[model samples]
Target: MAIALSQLIAETDQLLDAARFNDYCPNGLQVEGRPYVSKIVSGVTASQALVDAAIEAEADVLLVHHGYFWKGENPCVTGMKQRRLKALLDNDISLVAYHLPLDVHAELGNNVQLAKRLGWSIEGGLEADNPRSVGLVGAPAQVQTPQELAAQLALALGREPLLIAGSQPVRRLAWCTGAAQGYIDKALAAGVDAFITGEVSEPTVHFARENDITFIAAGHHATERYGVQALGEYLARHFAIAHEFIDCANPV
Candidate 1:
């Protein structure tokens, strides 16, 4: 089955409430392609490798969590940017992406999906007062030490997370996927026993130690693999169109 490109984009934007997010990049339809879409390929990022894989998959639209024209990026379409855009244009493939919207969506968002995968039950947003808080506070099925939680993260994400152990075992936990180490302060305010995010900064270790909160830095790419896939499957089921999620592996 096939759906009009406009319809697909509209549905996705509406479902994700893309307009609500103040994101670093545009939330939907970064690149336009054919009038209709029959096969969709979703990935974490629209890197050249993923673009090549999407082309090989014969995808009419490339759906992703990360897309081009990010804020503060050079506007010039040269070098790496030129090659990626040219490939998509030559193949007539549309590029659609969602950033913060995908992270905060109640059902298909990265945060919710990560919770589902790791057996954590979400209690509330990390910022208790903010309804649209990207980070979430939660608890595992059982209380776990930093090391045990690290092991589970390693098994679930296929990458060993960098753990800064705390004195207390993790009872209440907070997590926001993909370079959300900055939210540790918010997590601390939430009074969680531990915090988890992708890509730790140098200051994060000190904060965790001083605050007595366990910190886990799971790989950015590793932790974010599920939301786009879930969105792809939902699209496939909703429109009765073919959808494939291609993981172009990245360590960071």
Candidate 2:
């Protein structure tokens, strides 16, 4: 059954509560399409391929992590941004996105979902006092070697994770689902033996090596595809809407 665009927005806002996040981009509908939505497309980013998929499916609404109007991005909307938005506008497809909110949701969040898939029992947020922390701390069923854990991550993510091995076995682990190399310090403070994030910066290599923490650089796009897919499935079942996660492969 198709839901109205307004109702979809209301449901999405209620599910994610975008107001909670201090994100780079606006968290809700960035573009308006038809008043009613039957098919909803979910993806990691609203890239050209994803937009094309949405168009091919004739989806009414496109939900994603990376949407337009990023903080500090050129506001001109003249090139790639223009083309992306133009595709949505030209196809009359609505675009809705949730950034940190999607990453931080306790159950359906990216970090939480990854933890679950890896048999990690979450203890708390990596940020401690901050409730909106995107990174998470957790324990595996038992202590595993850094190599074992890295293998698990690699198998699950379908990519060989870049591992910076520490001397000790992994007991406590912290992870963030996307490009969160900056949270290395937070993980270190949390006393986790290993820190896993999607992408790694150059400095992160040195930090992990110097700090005696195992750092894993899993593919950013690979690590994030699950949360939104799970969310789409949940929303489809709960809200009785057609949902599909259109993955646009990104190596970085």
Candidate 3:
């Protein structure tokens, strides 16, 4: 069964509460395509590769967490940007994106889904003051040493996390998916034994070492892969539509 593109966007906007968050990119329906959609391809980013994959899948719509026209980015459609946009326009495939909205969705968010995969119990927000903190503080199923936590991350994400050692066992931890190394301070403020995020910065090592907190840098793509898939599955189940998650890997 085909669902109207407008209807799909409306349902997603409502479900993700897209308008409520201050996001760097547009939250819903970045590009309009055919009115009805029976097939959808979802991914973490809307790169040219993902667009090509969606086309290969005969997808009518491409749903993603990262999309075009980021705030403060050069607006001129040239080079890679031109090629990507042209691909979508030529194929008449809709582009829908939700950045912060996808990350922080309590039930289907990336962090929560990652937690489910690792058997973690979410405790609270890493930033207590921010009502929509994407980073989350949580407890592991069992207390683990820094080394053990690193191994768990490696096993779960299928990649070795850059582990910054801490002083003690990790009973409680905090995590955010996709380039959230900056949230480490908030995790430190929470005084969790460990903090896990997608990307790592030079200062992250210094901070982790000084504060004696374990820091884990799981791959950004691996960490963020879940939310879009969860959202795609939900859209599929809700509308009885055909949806496939296209994984376009990025090591960074």
Task: Give candidate 1 misplaced runs (Cα > 4 Å).
Answer: none
Model 1 per-residue lDDT tens digits across residues 200-244: 999999999988899999999888899999999999999999999
lDDT string for model 2 (1-252, tens) is 877789777877788877867788899889999998788899999999999999998889888888888888779978888899899999999998888888988888888888888899999989899888789898988999999999998898889999999999999999998889999999999999999999999999999999999999998998898788887888788768899888888888
Q: So what's the TM-score on candidate 1?
A: 0.99
RMSD from true fold, candidate 1: 0.7
Error of 1 at 78 (Å): 0.6
lDDT of each: 0.94, 0.88, 0.93
- Judged by lDDT relative to the true structure, which candidate is superior, 2 or 3? 3
Model 1 whole-model lDDT (C-alpha atoms)? 0.94
Q: In model 2, how large is the Cα lDDT of residue 208?
A: 93
Residue 171, candidate 1: C-alpha displacement in angstroms: 0.7
